[model samples]
Structures are given as C-alpha cells and as structure tokens.
Target: MNYLWPILILISLLFSIFRGTIQDINNSIFTSISDVVTLSLTLVGNMCLWCGLMKIVQETSIIKFLNKLLNPILKWLYPDSKENKEAMKAISINTISNFLGIGNAATPAGLKAMEELEKENMNKSELSNSMIMLIVLNTTSIQLIPTTVIAIRASLGSPNPSQIIIPIWISTIVGTLTGILITKILLRRRKI
Candidate 1:
C-alpha cells in the first residue's frame, strides 16, 4: 500500500511533465498541501474541544449511561463481542467520536476495537461478521454536529458556518442507515 502511493505519485509527475504541465502540478501540490495543513489544524482544534467534552461526559457518568442505553443496539451490532468489555468501550468511544464529528479522534478507538475483535476470533485470519458491521458503521457513521465541516467553513470565511448543520445531520443519518441496510443484505446473501 505504501509503495503504491509513491509509484502513483511518480506516474502522475511523469505524466504532468510529459504534458508540459509541471507548473500546474507544482501549484496544485502546494495548494493541496496548504489545504491539508489548514484542515488538519482546524480538525485538531475541534477534536480537542470534543475530546474535552467526552472526558467531562465520562467523568459525569454520561458515557456510562449512554453505554447502558445503547446496550441492546450494541448487542445486535456485535453479538460476538458480548464477553469483551474493552472492545465495547472502544466501540462506544468510536461512536461518541463519530457523533461529535471528530473523525481523527475516532480512528485510534476504531483500530483498538478491530484489534480486540481480531483477538476474539477463532479463525484468526478471517474477520467476523461483527467486525464487518463495525467497519460499515464507522465508514458511514452518523454525525450530529459536524464540527469538522463547520470548522472548514469558518476557516474558509463562510458567512454562516452553522448553516450546514441541518443538511449534514440529514445526510449523515440517511447515509448511515443505507450503509447498515446494505451491509446486512450482503451479509445475509453471503450466508446462503
């Protein structure tokens, strides 16, 4: 995977040079890196705020209450993970991060969940259904606040950064539902 990127970059650079678009390529690379750095800073700021909020929620037992409230749904989503508290904690944290629109913060938790899931698997090399479902959920996770989007809008000098809240909420909910449905259908088909 790492080698594939450098090869692709070399190919792109060669193509640009051949087409006499080296200047355009250079400008695009600079622009892309600048945008990445700006976005990274914004994400860091938003994630810090959300992580602090999460810590407060945890300290106040809000997270524990949420975990209890979500037990049924979690069971259905991760039937094989019933005995694993660490995996459940990681999943809960990942879910909280997604709900708060802190994708970067969610990554480590999601990775930990996968590692836990792998540990519990009998066929060590094969991913379980719960792992598959977790991946789908993470990919199309529903976000309420979309702090990242708002931060990007603010950074880009939007007139009203929060104006996108409703649209983002609606889209994320719908997308996540669709992803869940598709994953279930695929899993069912694979069973037969």
Candidate 2:
C-alpha cells in the first residue's frame, strides 16, 4: 500500500511529461492544494459544530431519549452486551453520531464501546460477538442526514447539495442491511 501510491504517482508524472502536459500537471497541483485547504477548513468547521452539538446532546436528556428509542434494536443486534450498561450507552452514542453523519464525533464512543465489550471477552486476543457487531455497525453506518457530504458539496458551490439525500438514504440502507445480514450469517455459521 505504501509503495503503490508513489509508483502510481510516478507513472502519472511520466505520462504527463511524455504527453507534454507537465505544465497542466503543475497548474492542477497548485489548484488542488488551494482547493484542499479550503475544503479542510470547511470540513473542520462542520466537524466542530457537530461535535459541540453532540456534546450538548450527551449532557442533556436527549441521550436518554435516544437510548430508549434505540434500545430494542440495540438489544437485538448486540445480545451479549445488552446487559452491560456502559457498553449499551457507548453504543447508543456511536449510533446517534453515525445517524447524524458525523462519524468523527462517534470515534470516542466507538472506542469506549469496544473497551466495554472487550471486558466481557473470554479470550484476551479474540474479538467478542458484541465487538464484531459494533465493527459491522460502524463500517456500514446508515446516515439519515449525511451532513458531512452535504457540507462538502455546498462548499464546492453545488446548486442543490441536498439532492443526494435520497440516493444516500437508499445506498446506506442497503449497505447497512447487507453488512448486518452477512455478519449474522457468518457468526451463525461459526457457531455450528
């Protein structure tokens, strides 16, 4: 992976040189740097805003409300960790963050949930069922809002950034369902 990128880049540079498009490459590099900086600032602002909002949600009764709503699904998804309050709480927070499409904000809660799950793990080196479920959930996060993507599109001067909402909903729902179903199938297979 480390060598792949440099090799690909070198090939691109060589191709551009041969095509007499080196100047175009130079222009693109400079333009891309500026664009990257602008995009980074926009992303940072959105992350900060959402993280702060998440903090507020955590401190208020909203978290309890959300936990109550998500409890049934969470219990079904994470049978092993259903009795562990800390794990359940962390999982709830991570789910809320992912649903809001602020994955960065979910990192802390995800890590905490992992830690809690690990405590119940019988084998020190092996993953617990709950841990695997958590991994699946995070990997196939089904976002309701997808705020980060919308922010990026809006920052890039999109006329209607929210136009992707329906597509995102469809794709994420399919991805999440597939991930969960596969995980369940694999886990069941392992048991027998």
Candidate 3:
C-alpha cells in the first residue's frame, strides 16, 4: 500500500516535470517553503506560550483537579483500564494538548497512552475498547482554541484572526460528538 503511494507520487512528479512548466513548479516550491517557515515560527511561538500555561496548571495541582473531575468520564471511556494511572495521565495530557491546539504535542502522548494500554492487555492482537475510544477521540478532538488557524490568519494579515474562535469551537464540538457517536454505533454493529 505504501509502495503504491510512492510510485504514484513519482509518476505524477515525472509527468509534471516533463509536461508542466518548470518555472511554475519552482515558484510553488519557493512559496511553499516560505509559508512553511512562517507557519512553523508562529506555531512554535503559540505552543511555547501554551506549554508554559500547561506547566503552571500542572504545578498548581490544576491538572490533578482536572483529572479528578474527569475521572468519571475517563472511567466510562476506559472501563477496561480503570486501574492504569500512567495510561490515564497520558490520555489526559493528549486531550489537554488537543484542547490547547497543539496537535504535534498530542501525538506522542497518545502513542504513549496506547503503549501503556497495550501492556495491560492480555490479547496482543485484539484492540481494547479503551484503545478504540482513544482513537476516535483523538481523530475528532475538540479544540478550545484554534491556535494554528489563528496563527495562519495572522500571518496572512487578517484583520480579525481571533474572530474564528466561536465558529471553530462549534465545528470542533460537532465534529467530536459525531465521531464519538459513529464510532460507538460501528463498534456495536461489529459486536453483533
């Protein structure tokens, strides 16, 4: 499957090189690199600020309070792994990262959570319900702030970059609820 993608990309690139204008490609490449660098800087700046806030939250026992507050929901989502504290922490961190709009940070924590869950599982081949729920939650995560999008908008010189906040919040909530509902329905169907 991966080989097919590389082959297809190679074919397309060769075709473009042979038939399409090289000048256009060069301009696109340069523009893309510039955009990437600008975006990277913006993301880094915003992430650092969020990370600092997260650290303060953690140090002040806000994270522990949050964990306690979320315990019931977490238990429901991860019924099979209720005793796994490390896994729970990882899951919380992953969710928190997503809430802060730091997807790049969330990925590693999500992987760690999965690894911890895998350790507790007796059946290595079969995924746990917790794993499935985690996957679904991560795929359509709710974001309180669309930091990356705001950064992009600012970089593009938008007059009101923060104006997207309400719309993004609504969309993220809808997307997350839809994803959870669909995943639950599919899983139930599979069981039957």
Candidate 4:
C-alpha cells in the first residue's frame, strides 16, 4: 500500500510526459502542491480553533461529566483500565474529541490514552484487546460534527456545508458500533 501510491503517481507523471504534455504535467504537479499548501493552511486554522475549544473543555467540569458517561463503555472494553483513571481520562478526551469530529484535536488525547494503556499491557510484545479496540475507535472515529469536512466545504465555498452533519453522525455511529462489535466478537473467539 505504501509503495502503491508513489508508483501510481510516478506512472501517471511518466505517461503524461511521454504524451508530450510535460508542461501540463508540471503545471498539474505544482497546482497539486499549491492546493496541498492551501488545504493545510485552511485546516490549521480549524484545527487550532477546535484544539483550543477542546482544551477549555478539558479544563472545565464538562470533561469529568463526559468521563462519567463514557466510563462504563471504556471499562467494558478495557477491563484492566477500569481502575486506571489516567487512562480513562485520556480515553474520555480522545473519544469526545473524535465524537465532535475534531480529529486533529483527538490525536493528543488518543496518544496519551495509548501510552497509559501501554503501561498496563503486561506483555510488551503483544497488543491487548483494549489496544486493538482503541486503534479501531481512532481509525474509524465516530464523528458527530465532522468540523474538518465542514471547514473544507466552507473553504471551497459551499453554502450548506453543515448539511452533512446528520449524515456524518449517522455513518460514524454505525461504523464505530460495528467496529466495536466485531472486535468484541473476535476477542471472544480468541479466548476460546
């Protein structure tokens, strides 16, 4: 998969060059580079804004309240982490940030959660059920807001960027739920 993307790009560039469209290829490459820069700048502002909000939430009582709500689910998924407040707290923040669709904001909390979870993993060579679940949750994050997508749409001049909120929420819910269910089922099978 890592080699596929570069190989594909190289093939496309070579093909275009061979077709006597070197100027077009050059323009396209530069244009893509410029677009990437523009997109990064756009995302940075949104990420910063959301990250600040997340920090404020973390500092407030709201996170504790959310922690309580999410605690049961985390406990079930990470049995050993039930007594680990640090891990639970990190998981809470990561989950909430992902829920709100601020994935950039979720990263730090996710990393923190993983680090804390790692400390509890008795066998350093193997991944725990909780760790696998955490990876699934982060990768297939449940997005209630999808702020990043909204930001991109707005940047592209969409008049109804927020219209996708419900769709995103629904999709993420299904995705997360399915991922968790599958993980749990597999874990049960492994135990047998």
Candidate 5:
C-alpha cells in the first residue's frame, strides 16, 4: 500500500509534465491543501458537538434504556457474546453511535467490543464469527441521522443539507441486510 501510493503520485506527476499541466498540478496541490484545511476545521467542530452530545447521552439513563431495548437484537446477532455483559454493552454503545452517524465517536466503543470479543476467541490469530459480524455491522452501519454527512453538506453550502437523508436511510438498510446475509452464508459454508 505504501509503494502503491508513491507510484500513483509519480505517474500523475509524469503525466502532468508531459501534458504541460505541471503548473496546473502545482496549483491543484495548493488548492487541495487549502480545501482540506477548511474541511478539517468544519469536521472538527461538528465532531466536537456530536461527541459532547454523546458524552451527555452516556451520562444520562438514555443509554441504559437503549441498551435494554437493543439487548435482544444484539444477542440474536452475537449469540456467543450474549452472556458477556461488557461486550454486549460496548456493542450496544457502538451501534447506537453508528446509528447517530458519529463514526469517530463510535470507534472507541467498537475497539472495546472487539477486545472483549477477542477474550472469548479460541483462535487468537483468526477473528471469531462475532468479530466478523461486528465488522460487517460497523461497515454497513445503519445510520438513522448521518449527522456527519449533513454537516459536510452544510459546510459546503448545500441549499438543503438534509436532502440525502432518505437515500442514506434506504442505502444503509439495504447494505446492512446484504452484509449480514452474506456474512452468515459465508460463515455457514466455511463451517461445512
């Protein structure tokens, strides 16, 4: 991966030089850097707001209530880790965070859930089924709000930043179901 990036950059440099667009590339680099800085600041502010709200949510009884509601579904999805309270709680928090579309905030909980699941893993080298399911769930996260995306759109001056909400809902639901179904089918085949 390290070599791949350098090679791609070199290729782009050579192409730009041959096309007499080296100046254009230089200008683009500066423009991109400026854009990145602006975007980063916007994202940082948005993240801080959501992360603070998440912290407050954790402090309140809302998390416990949500955890109770999610327990049955989580247990069905992660049967092996059903009895592990820590793992279950971490999973619930991670899922809730993802649903709120704050992936950066969800990361810590996801890592904790992975660690707890790892404790029960018989094979240290390979991931357990529950771990794989967790990965799928995180990747195909069924976002209910997708605040991060909306924030980006708003920062970019979109007329209606929330316009993509419906599409996001449909796509995330389809993606999550497809990912779960495929993971289950593949795991079943592997066992046989």
Candidate 6:
C-alpha cells in the first residue's frame, strides 16, 4: 500500500502535467481534498452511530445471540478460529459490522480480528488458513443493511436511496458465494 500510493500519485501528476492541464490539476487536487474531508466528517457520524449500536448489542445478550446464530457458519469457515475466544468475538463483531453496512465501523473490529489471528499464528511467515479465509470474507462482505451507501446517497439528496437495497443484496450474495468458493478451491490446491 505504501509503495502503491506514491507510484499512483506520481503517475497521476505526470499524466496531468503532460496533458498541459496544470490549472485543472491544481483545482482537482484541492477539490478532491475538500471532498475527502467533507466525506470523512459525514461518515464519522454514521460510523459512531453504528459503533454505539454494536457496543449496546455487546453489552446486552444480543451479541451472544448473534454470535450463536453466526457460530455454525463461522465454524465451518474456520473451524479453529472460534477456539480462540478473542479471535472469535473479534471476527463476530467484524462480521456484524459488515452485515449492518457500516464498513467504517467494521475497520477496528477487522483490525482486531487480524491481530488476534496473527497472535494465533505465532508470528509465522506464511499466512494461516484462517487468515486467508478472513481475507476472502472481507473482500466479499455480506452486506445486510448497506446503511453506509444508503446514507451517502441520502446525503447527496437522492429521492429514494433505499431503492438500491435489493440489488446490492442480490449482487453481494452472489459475489460472497463466488469469492468463498474460489478461496476454498485455492486453499485446497495449496494444501495439496
């Protein structure tokens, strides 16, 4: 990521300069920076709201309930993962945040999940099975609420932002299944 960003920025700058659009490039840079700041501020509220809800659910028995509901599938995905309680809980929160469509809220949980998984890995050089599976799951997050997208659309003054729910659900379900299938096949191949 560190290498990719500078290379990308350099390329973009070169392309803009070569195109003789330095004025446009300067305007675009400032506009993009402004947009990013505005967007981050807007997203902060949604993230805080969902993270608060997650905390509430955790305090209640609801987190346990959700974990229980998700346990079977999670076990199937990574049988040894739930054996580590911390990793299991982190993964559950990560999944729940993803389901609620609060990707921003999910970041901390995902990072925690990765940290827990790394601990379980014992500083191994190679990625563990659970790590691979987690990567796959994150790539194709199973979105239930898509609240972030909806909120963004609403903030942009869309007439009916909720209209995208059905389409996104359908598309994401297919994508998640496909990604899992591919990941499983590749992992199996690696083992063999």
Spell out the clash pairs found in candidate 6: none
* Model 3 steric clash pairs: none
Off by over 4 Å in 1: 1-63
**All models, RMSD in angstroms:** 4.6, 5.6, 5.0, 4.9, 4.9, 3.7
Rank the candidate models, highest lDDT first: 2, 5, 6, 4, 1, 3
Question: Relative to the unseen true structure, what is the C-alpha lDDT of residue 47 in candidate 1, on a scale of 0 to 100?
Answer: 70
Q: lDDT of candidate 3 vs native?
A: 0.81
Estimated TM-score for each candidate: 0.68, 0.69, 0.67, 0.67, 0.68, 0.73
lDDT for each residue of candidate 5 in 1-192, tens digit (9 for 90 to 100): 689999988999999989999999999989999999998898788667755766676678887897898988898788778988778877888898888776877877788789999999999988999999999999889988878789999999999999999998998898899999999898889779
Local accuracy by lDDT, each model: 0.82, 0.86, 0.81, 0.83, 0.86, 0.84
RMSD of 5: 4.9
Pairwise TM-score winner, candidates 4 and 6: 6
Q: Which ten residues in a row have the lowest lDDT in candidate 5?
A: 49-58
lDDT of 6 by residue, 91-143 (tens): 88888878877687787677778888999895498788888888888888988
By the lDDT metric, which is better: model 3 or model 6? 6
Compared with the true structure, what per-residue lDDT tens digits does model 3 show for residues 36-143? 999989878766765566556656776687688778878877777889887887788778788877787687678878999999988787887789899999988888
**Clash pairs for candidate 5:** none
Alpha carbon RMSD to native, model 6: 3.7
Candidate 2 — what's its lDDT?
A: 0.86
Off by over 4 Å in 6: 28-56, 124-127, 147-164
Residue 112 displacement in candidate 3 (angstroms): 1.2
Instruction: State the local distance difference test value for candidate 5.
Output: 0.86
Q: Which pairs clash in the backbone of model 4?
A: none
